[model samples]
Target: MKIKTCLIQDSPVFFDKDKTLDKVEQLTKKYAQQGCELIVFPESFIPGYPRGFSFGATIGSRTDEGRKLYSEFYKNSIDIESDDIKKLEKLSRSEQVYLVIGVTEKQQVNGSLYCSMLYISPSNGLLGVHRKIKPTGTERIVWGEADGESLVTFHTEIGKLGGLICWENLMPLARMAMYKKGVEIYIAPTADSRKEWTATMQHIALEGRCFVLGCNQFFTKSMYPEKYRSLVADQPENMCPGGSVIVSPMGKIIAGPLFGEAGALVAELNLEEIGLSKLDFDVIGHYARNDIFDFNVAKQPEMVKENPTPKR
Candidate 1:
């Protein structure tokens, strides 16, 4: 089957929940009208990514006010089973399109948040939600750690749909896990706008022999609060340059580098391309020599701490 996918590269409202959702809805509706079967959006598309602070600030810098803002943002974030996600679920069914969206997902119990991706099928409903295995640097202070249970690939009608958030794409073991699961169409919803990131995506497409849809957003210094203006003063032109792209199984750029604006890049993917691309360098297929160079990945051991009684 031929898979028609579109990547929506738009600037999400900075810490504004309702407005961001409105924008996403409008864009999704537009893409749906274009006969796009699957649409991929950028990381933390809802209530925007905590771009400045989450990327490069100390935990102490998160003042009471900042914490309150984050708490509000967290509260604004959609629950996995919330009505907002259900709306998107219904939209998928109505539009008869598969939707892969990135959002700041709030955990129900502890109320800790995670950078998450939700895979909603047109026919099958909510398929899977994968939290970023490890938040990049300062992001750990804002978002909670993801559990071991989230690494997965959802079997969809289009293909084996799977993804990892932002910098998690750099993690070797994480990529290998997805590769082993036989991910056909890998959706990379990232915030990285560097030229090198594009090269990395291209490499993965060739290495994994899977189509890579690399989606990023476009943001200016003005999009952020005035207090953080000095932080982004150096790179004025392409702060979060919209380099949303789609690479073929052969590591060829089929759709974009849709830079400097909010737009969508549509590409027609033929699954037959995979068979030809895998002819020479299939990571798990003909090219792999497990016995010759086997590398083991170590899992983190569970910690056991004793509870201490309070002194009277």
Candidate 2:
């Protein structure tokens, strides 16, 4: 089967959920009109990424200002079962296209938040959600840890759809688990916009022998507060310049390095490439050495405790 994927490279609505959804709706319509099968959006597309500063840092450097800003932003975040998700589901079905988009998810019970990716089917049904295993650095202060039970790949009409959020792509064990499940299309939604980020995606594509649909946001210094802007004024060009790209199994750039724009890059992927690329160096195939180096990963706490820890 041939898969057509589009990456929505755009600036998120800085800390505003309603405006972000409005932008998403418009972009979804545009991509659907163009006959794209699936569209991938950047991380924290809803309510915007925190950028580099605390939410309400201006009120006071210490005290309740930072907490107040976080609370406000959290309130703006979408609940997984909210009306907005229903609207997005309807849009996906009406457009007849699969959507793999990221959002800031707020838990209804405890009011804690999570960085989550939602997979909406063209049938207007909830497919799956993968929360970031670990929030990067300062993000930990605002987001909660994801449950180990949430690691899963959704079986969609398009293909074996699975993904890891942002820096989770750097986790070797996580990548191997996805590979074990035979993921054909690996969706990587990220906030990293450095020039080397594209190279990292290309490397993952070649290593997994699967199509990598890497989508990143196109943001700028203006996206954040002036206090935050002053710190990175030296390299303003890459504050969050979108370098979204799609790579084929052979590590070829098929779609884009779509920098400095709020748009999508559509690419047609020939599924045959997966099989073609894996013929030589399939990680689980002839290339694997069972006797010499057996790498085992266990999830159960009991199993983990029993196994010998590897030396650094």
Candidate 3:
């Protein structure tokens, strides 16, 4: 299968919920017009990744303004069934492409927040969501840990599609799990724009022998609110200079590595790459010794025992 895939490396409307939705719609149409069969956006692209700021959190402490900021964040989070998701669903249907978008999800259980990836298929509307199983560093203060069930891969006509956010890709067990699921096109949505991150992506492509699509946000100081600007004022001119790229099954740069730019990095993907690469090393197939190694995942992804749902 020769399919065109695009990784969107663009800035969000920085906490302006309405503008972000509009941006999603506009970008979907643009990529569709360009004949992309699937589009991937950076993690937390919806309300923008709350990077370069701690949200006033420290050891067992949170400021009043931090609490207030958290409140606004929850308000902006996508309510699974809300118009925010509906609009994106409708756009996917019209655009006729698969979309894997990162979002901050507000749960009905207690209105707790989670960093998530919403998978929308043109043929199936909203297929499912993959919440980040573990939030990184300060992220734990803001986002809830996900159920193991959210660690999943959804099969589609185009390929076995799935994604991980930022440091999740660095988790060896997590990567192995995706490989075990037979992920052909690995989508990595992250806020890490460091040059070393690119090396990690390349290693994953070689390790899995699957195409790796890395999507990161592109932004500068002006892209944020004036108040927030001071938070990242010390950050270089390119606060989150994008590192969007697509590496083939052979670990070769197929396209992109766009930095300091905002646009879709498009590439043509060949299904044959998977087959050819697997001939050398199929981690889950002829190369595996399942008899020696086994995973301890639940029959179904169960809720985390360590991090219970937050109290309302």
Pick the TM-score winner. Answer: 3
The TM-score, computed over Cα atoms with residue i paired to residue i, of candidate 2 is 0.87
- Candidate 1 versus the native: TM-score? 0.88
- Better model by TM-score: candidate 1 vs candidate 2: 1
For each candidate in the order shown, give its overall lDDT on alpha carbons.
0.81, 0.80, 0.85
Q: Give, for candidate 2, the lowest lDDT window spanning 10 residues.
A: 300-309
Q: TM-score for each prediction?
A: 0.88, 0.87, 0.93
Which is superior by lDDT, 2 or 3?
3
Compare candidates 1 and 3 on TM-score and give the better one: 3
After aligning candidate 1 to the native by TM-score, how far in Å is the CA of 221 from where it should be? 2.4
Per-residue lDDT of candidate 3, residues 1-312 (tens digit): 888999999998988778898999899899899899999989999898888777789998889988888888888888887888788888998998889998888998787999999888876778788889899998998899886688878777788877688999999988887887778889999999888888888899988889999999998878888878877777777788888989988889888788878888899999888999988788888888889988665543322122221457
Candidate 3: clashing pairs of residues: 149-301
Superposed on all Cα atoms, the candidates' RMSDs to the truth, in angstroms, are 9.1, 8.0, 6.4
User: Which residue pairs clash in candidate 2?
Assistant: none
Top-scoring candidate (lDDT): 3
Predicted candidate 2 versus true structure: per-residue lDDT over 50-142, tens digit per residue: 666544444325547677777877888989888988988898888878888888899989889999999888663667678888999878878
